[model samples]
Target: MTSYDPQKIIDIHAHLHSDLPSDPALRVKALESLLVEQGLVDPAAIDAWIDLYAEEIGPKRGAHVVARAWTDPAFKAKLLADGTAAIREFDYQGHATGHLIAVENTDTVHNVVVCTLCSCYPFSLLGMSPGWYKAAEYRARVVREPRAVLKEFGVALGEEVEIRVWDSTSELRYLVVPQRPEGTDGLDAAALAALVTRNSMIGTDLLKARA
Candidate 1:
């Protein structure tokens, strides 16, 4: 048998590799498989941990913040003025949430969030970024045509309302505080939290009146 140089093989293969997996989820799954194969971690353990963060801990944390802001004027004022400190009030802190900025949506103005450079999101609060959120098209088009992108997501704004797009960076992360839905005045904080949606928090969707 003849010996082949590994570097030479890799070089040839590199040329053939034109593009990467466009779907971030696919790429993540592939990487996870590789790690599992290498015995660096167990797949079941990784899934359980992810589920805990995504389902149990993630959106619920942000929902609580929104609920409090909706019900408590003082906390809402503090949250808008200083998101990082206000969020810490709930004992939610992580490296991913370094500098948090809460943008409030009102009758006159609406806020949307995006990461143009990369998928830099407040994972601690929002959990995993949606696949569409990490798409190149979204990253590029949302900043340029926010209204159109929002419309596609079934969120249409009035002509009088101003749309402000916040680009998240490594230094700061933004969370959209969606306006409280009408007819929810009687709802308590826990009930209000239940009405909060992940997309509303991301500014891609609006909070509808829950029956």
Candidate 2:
């Protein structure tokens, strides 16, 4: 139950090679070494923090929240009204989720999140931010051309649908509550949670009814 999948983290870090080094791993290693040398960061503390994220907080918590919202009207209302307080019920509050705001997607409206300034994200709930999310291109273009960006992610919306882009900051972050797929009325919370995907929660992919 790692906060994020290791392979995904690797994939995210893989795209970080630019002016530093061709190999991202080497670049990270060098940075860590320098930081350690300057006494700016402790290796053990960093390891502990990584382990905490990898072992405790993750997208599963977000899926659980989504599952409850799908089944409980009251909780869903509360979630949309005050996401920060609603998530505290599960003791899922942590790190970047302290100032969370939940936005729902409907037939006529879609929601997406971006951090135009940096890679700010609800990491405690959504796990680690994806590589593309940290890229300068995404940070710049998502706000200006969200529909086109979403379409590239395989989410095609009709012209009638309004797309809202939320910009996350260090003080506030956004979580998209994707529309629950139809044909899942009989599914329990656990079953429903199993169907939730990180991309859907990020508003990049639309969930389809279970077949």
What lDDT does each candidate get? 0.89, 0.89
- Tens-digit lDDT track of model 1 for 64-125: 99999999999999999988899899888675777899999999999999999989888878
Give the clashing residue pairs of candidate 2, or none: none
lDDT of 2 by residue, 163-203 (tens): 99888766888889999898989999999998898888888
Candidate 1 local accuracy as lDDT? 0.89
**What ranges in model 2 sit over 4 Å off?**
1-42
Clashing pairs in 1: none
- Runs of candidate 1 with Cα error greater than 4 angstroms are 1-48
Candidate number achieving the greatest lDDT relative to the actual structure: 1
Clash count in backbone of candidate 1: 0
Worst 10 residues of 2 by lDDT: 11-20
